[model samples]
Target chain A: MDSFVLPSFISPNSEDIKRRIYARIRSDLHRIEAEIDRNINSSIPLISVVARHIMGSGGKRLRPLLMILSSRLCGYTGDRDVSLSVVFEFIHAASLLHDDVVDHAEFRRNQPAANTIWGNPGVVLVGDFLYSKSFLMTVGYNNIRILEVLSSATTKMAEGEVLQMVHSDNLEVDEEEYLEVITRKTAVLISAACQVGAIFGGASPEEEEALRAYGHHLGIAFQLVDDTLDYTGDVKELGKPVGNDIREGKATLPLIYTIKKAKPSVKKRLGEIFCAEEILPENFLEVREMVMRSGGIEYTLHSAIEHVQKAKESLDIFPAHPTKETLVEIADYVLCRRV
Target chain B: MDSFVLPSFISPNSEDIKRRIYARIRSDLHRIEAEIDRNINSSIPLISVVARHIMGSGGKRLRPLLMILSSRLCGYTGDRDVSLSVVFEFIHAASLLHDDVVDHAEFRRNQPAANTIWGNPGVVLVGDFLYSKSFLMTVGYNNIRILEVLSSATTKMAEGEVLQMVHSDNLEVDEEEYLEVITRKTAVLISAACQVGAIFGGASPEEEEALRAYGHHLGIAFQLVDDTLDYTGDVKELGKPVGNDIREGKATLPLIYTIKKAKPSVKKRLGEIFCAEEILPENFLEVREMVMRSGGIEYTLHSAIEHVQKAKESLDIFPAHPTKETLVEIADYVLCRRV
Candidate 1:
């Protein structure tokens, strides 16, 4: 509901801050990656093969990183953080596999999507395996609250996907409805990751909420940038062509904005394109250009930047600490990332 | 690993016993159905639509019924049994939704499969919704053991599907591997249902073990009968054609037995049919007759009857009670059910 507004608190050295933070967390990230590899193995060779195919195709481990950083920000020092971090990764990986199947996506993270290689049924089942496996791993913690948060996040995520499906390709979708979709589909998991990290770190309720807010805003910003990048990012970095969202008839933030802000003639043309049975490559590029002309990309980036600022502001309740600084840097990284 | 050897324990009047048991538990079963109906409700209308479409379709509510009967057999006299019964049903229904997509099944329980009506993406996501919703419900129990059992069952179920995929259309699949697949895919959930019911019912460790074994054997018997029904039952009652397993290239117990006992020429023909790109309807009928002539149906029924006897024998440790009697009757019903 909040408009994109930059507060007076953030530093301009985001890139420099991210570089230092990466160096500090390098070993921990390695351990998390190792645990992720170990956790995905199964007695069934194909399950392992399909799981490894996607897991090995690296995406930035942003969700797991949030859990780790939030734990540190809460002044927690425990070995459990490493394994706990892997839980969100499994959930994220599982969702990506399913999403790829749902989207009929060909590439993910600069590689062929798991569905493209293993077929939809195998990918779908493996996604289920990862999901159940994540829950199984959480039982070792013996914490009901952790399970509650994780399970609730998963439920909301599924609901979010359904909501997105309900609203798919509907040109009437507004900013508020789009926000709801991204919140459920993407932000809930990120928020849960941070909240669970706080819970494991023994933070007070207030502190937990603060971190949760930070993660929520960060996740929203992350997804906003993701949607904008669908029209703006380079193909090599995105591992797919620009205008894919349009091809799939997804009314993402930029396109939705474009529809609202464009001239009547432009809107009419956009409607014609959307109504067409096949969206040709040239039409896709034409829509991208029109969206740019209508300032949709800039508006979306502005919204994302505002969310990044709000995310950093949410962390102001926490005391100044090294981990808190890293969290701020990650917030900046989300805005600055090209893919 | 054990051979299917019929024991001298099962009563011949399974149908009469089942009818009496159903008469007694009529109220409890009704309550469970209501809870299941309540649990499946969602804010998303489409999700509710997709979920209800499948949940309302009449498949035997066998898994949830097992949980309720197992709870009652352990002398559980609480309302939790009714709500808890819904958990296994949600899991079972969720698995069925996904399985339909995986098997590309057109019909289930005399209705078009949810996947067929809602499309695969919506059905897959709704299945996920049910899965997470089920977990969310379990967290309300605040019992870590319940979470453990449910999560483990889900993991094994996913693994079982993968194993089945690996074995699909492969005639070399032996009985041992087939049993492993069915156990992971189908038996584990039933076993978890009973074990979870026991946990909620305050069963002693030994009592829990007995119920768990009862469920495991009953699940095996149930699946054996299911495979046999695909060969022997009326299509209207089974809610599917008789040659579906053969069409899908699944090597169920009946087909596996037929492969093992058929004459060399028959075995070669069976191999050829399985290897062909598409199994013709006439060929499917021919294979069915061959399996029948090779005594495959009889062997599978013998195996199911043995499991039913084993399932009943596992209940010997429990004291005589009406609930125990019902549980025993249900075991026999698993053997004799036509659909």
Candidate 2:
């Protein structure tokens, strides 16, 4: 969620959070690799090649880092969170790898997508491998709550994918429908990351609910910003192909928002171009221009800010803690950052 | 793995094992549907439609029943063996549903395939849904060892699929390589079912190993019979087109064996037909006849008997109990029984 990246005032605090998480995640990443080799009977090198390449591709580590920081905010002292957080990261990574294959995406984070290098079969199976391994790690906790939360998130993620498949290119998609898909596809896991932290920390039910709501709102803010950025993003800065989501025919938030406010005649043209068999690069620019002029981008951004506000306000229920402040700060960063 | 089917056997003891295992499995089948529904969280109607169709298809429940019986032989008393065994079946069923989509298969177990009824996307997503659900159920156990065993089996199964994909139409596939694919594709989970049972019963490592061997051999034998039945099996018994695998150019054991033993010219003809886009239906029958005449089917049956014998031997290490007897009987059943 680019919205979580704040400027000068929050930079140091965010850096502090990242610094603490970075250290644990590094070893946790290694441990995950070690376990991959130790437990999986496949040839070690293939797994290592795909794994290291992706792990080394250098993600923002946003999800795993959030999971760890969430656990810290909840005062988690257990060692399981590190492994569990890594599981969160691996599941995230695995899904991306498979998504690239399914979407035939050529790049991720400006690096060659793993599927591009490994081929679709390896990518698909390896993604399945990581999923199985993630479950293997989580089973150590034996908490039905833990399993239930993560499992439900995964199911929702798949449903979201299916929903996207059904809705993609159907240019009449409204913001509500787009929000539902992205919430399940992108936000649920982020939400689960925080909720699981509260779970593993043995937080009170009220606190857990607050944490879940916080993560859910924060993730919504992050994804809304992502949808906005896709319209007016710098591919170099975002590390993804500009207009990639639209090319895939997904009617993401900004476009949907714009369509909502547009005159019916203008909306019809936008819808037609989006549903067309072929779209020129110029169409991407033209569509973005239309949305900006119509104030749709601004509206989506405002919606993101609202979510971030909700995310931060939910944090007030928790007693003061350093990590809590960082949590609140991250929420603020998501909406203001310009990735 | 049809190399492990029954000879013309006169022993009543083996027959008794069949009856007992069937009886146990029949009752457990009811719970399998319930467990599947409890875990599936899709649009309730979608889940209901798929689950109802699948369980209502009248599957033999052989694998789950075998798992339960094998666990019992190792002195397991807990009822969890049944749930775990159902987990085994769900994975099996889910794989078939997905495989039908990947292979574009039209039929399964003598009925119209789920994909044909539900369409590929619906079938594929539901398969994924079922798979993740199975993982969730396995995670519910909280036993690291069991989780590792089943998760590893799942990975093996995926790799096995890739192997099968690559080896398609490869008539030169030697017996050993053929065995490797099926072991992962078909046997590992069956083996894990028994092994995990022993583990859950707190059996010694040696005992678990022995139980795993039994299941491994039995599974190989089971699959071997399936391969044979593909050509020679009764449609009423096996369901689906018996000749489909051959028509699709699968270089299974019967074909591999006959090709190895055939006259050089016959082998050349076999090679020509395998690579062609379509083989004459008569040519398919000719190959079948040749396989039978070359003793391919007979040889496969003997191998099945040998595996079942070995499977029985794996249980001799245990003290005499009715459960042990039943397990031994199951091994015999694998070699001998029919629909």
On TM-score, the candidate that comes out on top is: 1
The TM-scores of chain A alone, one per candidate, are 0.94, 0.88
Q: After superposition, how far is residue B129 of candidate 2 from its true place, in Å?
A: 1.6
Where model 1 places Cα greater than 4 Å from the true spot, the runs are A1-18, B1-15
Model 2, span A1-339: residue lDDT tens = 122222243243545655554454566555545543444344535665676666666565567667777777777865666667777777787778657755778888778888788676566656666776677678677676787788778877767766776786787887788889889878898998888888888788888888899989998999988887787766677788678888989887778778878898988889878988888888887887787788777778788888998998888888888778767767866765545
Give per-residue CA lDDT, model 2, range B131-205, as digits (tens). Answer: 776766766676767777887788778768767766777888999999998998888878988888777777788
Q: TM-score for each prediction?
A: 0.95, 0.80
lDDT of 1 by residue, B100-143 (tens): 98899998878888888889899889999999999999998999
Tell me the TM-score of candidate 1's A chain.
0.94
Over the full model, what C-alpha lDDT does candidate 2 score relative to the true structure?
A: 0.74
Q: What DockQ do you compute for every candidate structure?
A: 0.82, 0.30
